[model samples]
Target chain A: MSTEELQAWLRRFAELVHEHKDELTALDSAIGDADHGANLDRGMTAVLAALEEAPPADAAALLKKTGATLVSKVGGASGPLYGTLFLRMAGADTFPAALRAGYEGVLARGKAEPGDKTMVDALGPACDALDAGRSVAEAAQAAAEGRDATVPLVARKGRASYLGERSAGHADPGATSTALLLQAAAETLS
Target chain B: MTVGIVVVSHSRALADAAVELARQMLPGRELVVEVAAGTEDGGLGTDAMAVSAAIEAADGGEGTVVLMDLGSAVLSAETALEFLPDDVRERTTLSAAPLVEGLVGAVVVAAGGATREQVAAEAGRGLAPKEAQLR
Candidate 1:
């Protein structure tokens, strides 16, 4: 992705996050600490301000700045996990490759697998779809499906794991946000 | 060299209070310590960047042992290690001990000029007393 596309994708993500903040927080309240929405919204707003204050020269620079901003500003689990994702995406050769690397970064940082009912649920399928030569729009659709699939999963990782069986009914908040990320990517980076 | 202790917690009040309680274990001696807790605005969260800063501040050129409350605090501490200098990162240890009790034990041990491993080991032993009493 070019610098402009990366910037657009993050901006779109911030917008989607703002639009769905309550829904995300509501989902989190069902099984998490109820701060995912607020934390991410705060972080993204900082990212926007940082980007405006110092526009990055390239895709790598943009991703690095975004990652660093999130790590410093989010102040939650999402901060390091999502921050690592963007940081790992900096040097990849293609959008799909960058996303795949980001998925791996999340995996390494969060240590959550597909069925663990985290962002990996949505991001994993989206990465697979993109790797299989699917359109960015199709990958976004796959991410939405993955997010929907989380409604029945018993979270085995993250703070939701504390609820054990009770965590099954709610769609994973991380998955929901991951779907929004892919959707934003489809809109801007594609 | 005295091992330094840095507490990473979701609440600034909690970390500050816990450190207050822990430091009571060492009366006159110096216990190199730092707190990397809460958001910049004092919300309930953990900032990796702040954590990175705390680790640097806590390091007395000997070593640092980071104790986290749980969850994201641990993740933040781990992420902070990535930003440290190679020498500091190699000497730093992330203790998997319970926050409050562990801080108490760690502070005492670190005040005695313990090694990094010994400080971490003392922190891990924080629950032993409670466990023993319960048993």
Candidate 2:
């Protein structure tokens, strides 16, 4: 993707994060610290501000800056997890490959699996779809489906895991946000 | 003769208080303790970039040990290692120790001229006293 397209993806994801901020927080309140929405929103806002301050020269620069901004400004598990995603993406040659690398990074960083009722649930499917030569829109759809699938899984990672069976009925806030990210990529990069 | 320490907590006040408590363990000794806590906006969270800066600041060339408050704090501290210089990063350790208790033990051990591993081990066992009390 071109730098402009990547920038658009960031803007789209930031806007989505803003719109869904309360919803994300509500979900987190069910099984977590109830700050995911506010945290990601703050991080995205800073990301946009950073981008505006210095427009990046390439996709790598844009992704690196975005990742670093999130790592610094997000200030939560999401910060390192999402930051690793974009940072790993910065070195990959293709968007699909980047997604794969980013997914692996999350898996490594979080030590979470697809059935862990974490972002991996959504991100893993999206990566699989994209790696199989699916369109970005299709990958986004896969992510949404993966997110929906989280409602039935017991928590196995993250703060949510503390609740065990009590966490089964709640949708994962991280998966919800990851789906939004894939959707933004589909919207802007595809 | 000291292993630097970094306290990563979600609350700035919490980190400051913990540092104070830890520092108190050594009345007149030199203990390198740094805190990377809360967001820049004064919110409750852990900033990896801040943790990275703290790691560098806490390092005394002996090594640095990180003690974190919660899950995010641990993740942020781990991520912070990526931002450190190669040699400095090589010696840094992220201790899976409870915040308050661990910091106190780490500070005490560090002040006594222990290595980073020893300090971390002391921190790891900080929970022993409490657990023994409960038992």
Candidate 3:
């Protein structure tokens, strides 16, 4: 997708979060601090406000704004990890390359690996799929599958890790959200 | 009422999810919200080009505020500033607020065409804790 199209994808994703804040919070309650939904909701809300005040001049600035907001407000591992991801991606010039670079930044900053039952499990594969020249639709499908794949793996990072083996049964909230993002990208680009 | 909102997240899915939620919230509103998402796999976060374009789009008439998720995002955003034209950059404001609250609040205000000052005030408000209990 072109950079403009990619921006639409992000807008769509934010809309989804608003719609499902309660559900996401509920899911997070099971294995996390029970604030995932609320936290994300709150964060996005601020993002919307920030945009209204001073709209950025380009895609990189927008993403950078997002990353900083999350880090400063979220107040958890997600804040830093996700923040770094955007910060890095904001530096890239293309969709695919930015996607790959963003993923790598998340991985490096979060210090999580594939199969650790973290969001990485889903994200890792999705990046690979996109890198393989898969269509946005195909890549999004892969991302959904990757999110689902998190169900059986053991949590080794973030709050899910606190559950240990018990975390195996539940889907990672981050991963589920990741899938939704890919879906938005596909929809907007398509 | 022309307002711009930005979504930032580590997971593309998460950012996309937020966007979807926003669409549902104001189905008929002619608001402009943007997403700056991180990669799915282990790579860097958000695309600079995407963020820059979104900012440029927001600069049409109403100004914009850039919201981000974390440290690196803030840093990268600082770097991306170079890509924007002086005028557009002058109209843009960057904040470090909570993602969810900031985004939702901004959507509501921006959709209503709140002034830049009003929007910044709302964005600042998002940094505070929410009163709702986590169910």
Interface RMSD of each: 0.7, 0.7, 9.9
Q: Find the candidate with the highest TM-score and give its number.
A: 1
**Candidate 1 chain A, poorest ten consecutive residues by summed lDDT:** A1-10
DockQ of each: 0.80, 0.82, 0.03
Tens digits of per-residue lDDT, candidate 2, A1-190, equal: 7898889999999999999999999999998889999999999999999999999888999999998999999977999999999999999878999999999988888989778888999999999999899999999999999999999889888789899899989889999999999999999996
* Ranked candidates, highest DockQ first: 2, 1, 3
Query: Would you list the C-alpha lDDT of every candidate in the order shown?
Result: 0.92, 0.92, 0.69
For model 1, how does the per-residue alpha-carbon lDDT over B12-101 read when each residue is reduced to its tens digit?
Answer: 999999999998888888888899999989799999989988989889888899999988998888888888999999989999999998
The candidate that wins on DockQ is 2
List RMSD in Å for every model shown.
0.9, 1.1, 15.0
Task: DockQ winner between 1 and 2, please give it.
Answer: 2
Which stretches in model 1 have alpha-carbon errors above 4 Å?
Answer: none
Give candidate 3 misplaced runs (Cα > 4 Å). Answer: A1-3, B1-135
